[model samples]
Target chain A: MISMHLTYDAQKVYMKVLEECLKASSIEYELNGWSEVKLKGQPALSEIRTFKNKLREAGIYVIENSRHELIQRTKDTISEMILHQEDLKSPKLSTYLTEKLNYSYTYLSKIFSEHTHYSIEHFVILKKIDYAKKLLLESRLSLTQISYKLGYSSVGHLSKQFKKTTGMTPTAFYNIIQKRNRTL
Target chain B: MIRGFLKLAVVEDDKSSKKLFQKAINESTLVAGMIFFQQSNELLEYIDGPQNHVPDIIFLKLDPMVKNFLKDLRQVRKQHQLRNTLIVIYSSGASEQLIEDTFVYGANVYMDKPHTYEKFREVVEKILKINFQYLESNLNIENFIYRT
Candidate 1:
C-alpha cells in the first residue's frame, strides 16, 4: 500500500511536469491538468529543451521516477526553498532540509553530492545566484533589499557571492540589463 | 447557480494540495478570482494589510507547525471586521473537540480534504452551494459545521 501510494504520487508529479512544459510552449495541448495530456503533434527536441530550460530557470525541478526517489525529493526541496525566498531566512539550510526531508543533513548531503556531482551547498548557492539574477532584472528593488530578501547577512556578502558565481557583480549585471532594456 | 461572483482565498501549505484545489475551483465560473497562500503568516499579512479584494470565502488548511493559526484567524476576522466572510477549515483529520473549537473561534465550516480529484471538485461545489445558497436564502446561524 505504501509503495502504491508512492507510485501514485510519482505519477502525479510526472503529469504535472508534463503539463507545465506544455503550458510553457506556444503549441496548444488538451490537458485537464490530470490524466494523460493529448498533444496535437510531437514537440521538436529544441522546443522540448526550451521548455525544460524554462522550468529550470524558474527553479522548478522535475525529476524522472526511474532515478532515485531521494534525489528527486532533495532537488524538489532545494528548488522550493529557492523559489519561495521566504524560507531562505529561518532554521538554516541544513536544518531546514533535515526537518523537511526527514533525513540526516549529512546523509542528504552525501547522497545529493554523489548523484549530482556538486555539493549541496554549491547547489544552493547556484540557486540563490539564479534567484538574485531574476530579482535584478525583474524588480526595481534596491541591492540591499534584494540581498536581505535572499537572506544574505549583508549586501557585501551577497555581492561577493554573486560575483563569485556569475563572473560579474550584481550591479554590473543590473547595468547590462538596463542597457539592454533601453536598446529594446 | 451561485448567486453572484465570488472571491476566494485558500491557505494550504502543500503544493500538490493547493494545485488540486485550484484546478477544481478553476472548473467553475462562479468564482471571480482566487488567492493562494501557503502559510499562516502570509495569509495573516494579506488579510491584515491593505487589500481591496476581501474574499467572500476562505479555505484554510490546518498545519501543526502553526500552533496559533486558528486563534490568529479568528482574531483577524474580528479585528478586521470581516464578519460576513465565511471561513472554512480544511483538514484531513481532526478531533471533534478541535472541530468544535474551530467553530467557536469563528470558522463557518469544516471539511475534510478529499483525496480524489472528483471528490475535491464535489467538495468545492457542495460548500459553495450550501454556504451561498442556503445561508443567503435565510441567514441562519445554526447551519455551520459541515462534515463528510
Candidate 2:
C-alpha cells in the first residue's frame, strides 16, 4: 500500500480557486501575476462580496486596504511591463506608470517604498534580471538579443546590470546552468 | 592555504549554542571571520553604522520565544547594502507557517539546527559552496529549504 499523504502546489491551487471564484461572479479579469488580478472595471460590492466569500472558503482573503491594493497594482504593472516587453515602447517607466495609474510618480514611489522597503527602480531591475534568467534558461535567444529585448542600450550595459544584481557575469551564469544540467 | 575568506555573522543568544556555532564556523575552510550577536538589534546596528560592515552571510536563529524574530528578519532585509547578502535562517524546529513567512520576507535559505558539531560544520561548508547568486535568482518554495 502507498502510505503517504499527497501534497499539492499551494500557488497553483490558489490560482485555480481564484479563477473559479472570478468566473462564478461573472467578473472579467486578467491574471496580472501569480497573486494579482486586474479587473476590467470596478467590481460591484455584491460581486466583491460573493468573490470574497468563495475565496474565504479556500482560505484566501482579498486585501481590502486601498494602499495594499495600490501596491499590488504597481507590482502587477511592473511585472507586466517586464514580462511582456511592453516597456520597449515607453519612453520612461515613471512616465508610463504616471499615465497608466493616474498618480504622480513621486507619490507612487514613496508609498511603494514605505510598504515594500525597496524602491520601485530596484524592483524593476530585479524583475528584469529574473526575466533575463528565464530567457537564458529557455536557450532560444543570444545574449545580445536578450540585451536588446530587455531594452538595454548595449550588451555591455545588460552584462553590467546582470552582474550587479547577480554576482556572476551572464556567461558564468550560463556555464553554471550547463554544469547543473550535465550533473542531473 | 587561504581559508576563512568568507565573512559570517551569527545572531544567536544562547551561550552554549554560540560556542558550538563559533567552533563549527571556525572549522569551515570557507569562513575567514565570524561575528556573534546576542541580539538582533546589535547586528542591525553593526550593519547600519557609519562603518557599513556587511557580512556575506548571516545565520539568524529563529525562535518563537524571542520577541520580534520575524521583525528582525524584515529589518535586516530592509538594508539596501545587504541586498546581495545571503540570509540563512536556522531553527531547532520551526513551524511550517513560520518557515514560509521567512521566505516571503526575503530569507534566502532555511536550515534545521544540526545536533552534532560535525554536522554543523558540514552544513556550513555546503552552504558556502553553493552559488547563492544563482539560487537567489531561481528561488522558489521547492528549493528554499536546506537539508543535509
Candidate 3:
C-alpha cells in the first residue's frame, strides 16, 4: 500500500466548477482571473439565464455591470502583457491594449483613468519597473541585459525610470544588497 | 549584519488568509522564518519584548473590521528597530483614499489581496526577491500599490 497526502485549493476548485458550468452552457469564454470571464459572443437571453443558473448552483455570480467588466478586462490584459513580455508583438502598449481589448486607446485610457484615478500609461510604467526590479534581484542579468529584456532603448533610459520609481539607481540597489549579504 | 535568510511577520485575523500565507511563505526559498499575529497589538507587543527577532518584512492585512489598522501601522513605523524593515499592507477592496493614506503613513507596498493560490504564491515570491532595505524609506506614491 502507498500513502500520500494531497491538499486542495479552494480557488482552484471554484475555477474547475466555473469551467464546467461554462462548458455545459456552451459558452465560448476566456478565464482571466477566478472571478473575471471574457465571453466570446453575446449569448441569447435563455442561454444566459441557463449559464447563470448553473454558476449560481456552484455558488458563483456573474458580474453584469459593464463598467466593472471593462475595468477588470483592461487590468487583466495589461497584466498578461507584462507577465509574457516575449509574447508581446504590438509596437506600443496603447496599440497592444487596443488590439487585445478591441477598444480605441483613447476610450480605454479614459475609462481606466475615470475608474482607477490613474492613467493606463502610469500603471504600465509601475508594472514594468516592478518587473525590472524582480529581474535584477532574482536573475544574473546585467544592466544592459535587463534593459533590453524590458524593451528599453538603452541602459540609461532604464536607469532613469528605475531611479524615478525606486529613488535609487540599479547599481546602488545592488550595492545595498551586496553590503547586506556581506554582513550576513 | 542580518542573517542570510529572510525573517517575515504577518498580522492577519482571517484564518483562511493566514493559512494561505503560511503555505505561500513555506513554498518560497527566500523566507527562513515567519511569525503570525492575529492582531496588530499582539505584533506590537512581540516587537517590544526583549530578545525577539526583528523581521525583515512585515505583512499587515488592512481590513476595516480590524480596529486601529492605521494606528498600528504608525506604531510600527515609529519603532527604530523596524526603520529598515519593509512594511507591506494588503486589502481585498481598498479605495484610492485608503491606499493613499497607507502610503502617507509609511507603508512601503500595498497589495490587492490575491484570490487564488497561484497569484498569492507569485506575489509572495516576487516580494521576497526584492531588496527593500534601501528602498523602504524612499517609496513614492506612484509605486506604492503593487497589484498582481
TM-score of 3: 0.44
For model 2 the TM-score comes to 0.42
lDDT measured at residue A176 in model 2 versus the true structure, 0 to 100? 50
Off by over 4 Å in 1: A1-184, B1-3, B141-143
Give one digit per residue, the lDDT tens place, for model 3 in A1-184: 9999999999889988988998887879898867788778745545666888988888898655686578678877876787777655536888888989999999998977654545678667766787777777789998898888777889999999887765567775555445434332
Identify the runs in model 2 with alpha carbons over 4 angstroms from their true place.
A1-184, B1-4, B131-148
- Over B11-63, each residue of candidate 1 has an lDDT whose tens digit, in order, gives 87788987888898877645667899877567667767775457778888865
Which portions of model 3 miss their true places by more than 4 Å? A1-184, B1-3, B131-148
Leading candidate by DockQ? 3
What DockQ results do all the predictions give, each relative to the true complex? Answer: 0.01, 0.04, 0.06
Number of the top candidate by TM-score? 3
lDDT of 2 at A92: 85
DockQ of 2: 0.04
Cα displacement (angstroms), candidate 1, residue A178, comes to 62
Candidate 1, residue A156: lDDT = 98
Task: Give the range where candidate 2 chain B is weakest over 10 consecutive residues by summed lDDT.
Answer: B136-145
